[model samples]
Target chain A: MATWLEGLIALVLIIGGVFLLIGSIGLVRLPDLYTRLHGPTKATTLGMAGLLLASSVVSSITQGSISVHEWLITLFLLITAPVSANMIAKTAMHHDLTPWKRTKGQELVDPASRQAPPSDHHSVKDGKLP
Target chain B: MLTWAVIIVAILICIALFLNLWRLVQGPSLQDRILALDTMYINSIALIILYGIHMGTGLYFEAALLIAMLGFVSTSALCKYLLRGDLIE
Candidate 1:
């Protein structure tokens, strides 16, 4: 039973590793910043979750006690990855970085207004308007 | 049997590392580099866990945790710098 359990855990780890590998590859191959972020945020989260599951299984089997460390890391990664990506995208917009647009063939759009600039967009009182 | 599995996972992690390395090498913009670094951070954490399994030591878990913590801080700092050209206002 222990051996079988180990095999199962190993399978999970391998699958997770493959997902990570694919995500990294997507990061490289994707054309634009927005498109690239899609790969790592989605794929790496799934990959990390799988690896953590494997770790939890191994820890439980070997030590005969449940290990919660991997679970915590997985939870943290899931919560943080999307927030970080969103922040980066927003920052890029705030700073006027170029975004890859599919229809326009890489035309540079104003970072603050990827569409139209708001007349009241910049407000000192609200502190919420950028 | 477990040993073999661990070795396989380690090899796969190495491949992932190489993929991220490629991004680091050829990324066109600063943000791309930051993204690559973030991905690399997570890859290292996974690698450390596999190493822990191989050596039968739990010490590496602490290292993994540290890397995860540092990774978030570093990425945030980079993002902040990219935004305002300063880490602190």
Candidate 2:
């Protein structure tokens, strides 16, 4: 392997590792469920993307062919991470889980927890159901 | 040189997994625990990919892909169950 290739892999790997660590730390230290949700859904997903990119690069060069599996994983993750996070957020709202005390936009959360959409149209209008 | 990078990243991901476990154990709410679990699986995917790179093999690709798919499914299912109190309804 060339020195530049080694450097590229190292750079990507270290950055991905750092982001992964940051996401986990945020999950542990964040004060509220809503706050904690931001960590993994965004940072960790990005971190995984970085790792997958590095893997694809390494595999493609080593195997002398394009690697499709890593790209598939990355695509699936990008599509699904948000969906899962949204579902979890909806779950939190349904349970009326409290947000951090200093969290802004307090009024919106109150009614969202109390409001039960009666129909598909209204649920879509409510902007809370997906 | 690539080996050293992979080793460093693997250690970092291991630390991340441990932190996620800590949160999973001590999370104050149901969703918090779920979030921790979700993060845990994502980190595991990273670890697996790093290991594949370290070994210079594509053999682990399927395993990583499987984990990614299953992790998302499980997380969404858990959230849905919590929201509606029913899995099939």
TM-score of each predicted structure versus truth: 0.86, 0.91
lDDT of 1 by residue, B1-89 (tens): 77887888788888888988999888887788889899999999989888877776666888888888889888988888877788777
Residues B1-40 of candidate 2: C-alpha lDDT, one tens digit per residue: 7888898999999999999999999988999889998898
Q: How well is each residue in A53-102 modelled by candidate 2, as lDDT tens digits?
A: 89998998999989777989899989988998888888888798878898
Q: Pick the candidate with the highest TM-score.
A: 2
- In candidate 1, clashing pairs total 0
Which residue pairs collide, candidate 1? none
Strongest candidate by lDDT = 2
lDDT of 1 by residue, A80-129 (tens): 89888977776656656666657242333452534444435555334444
- Chain A TM-scores for all candidates read 0.77, 0.84
- After TM-score superposition, what is the CA distance of residue A86 in candidate 1 from its true location, in Å? 1.2
Model 1: per-residue Cα lDDT at residue B35: 90
The per-model lDDT (C-alpha) reads 0.80, 0.87
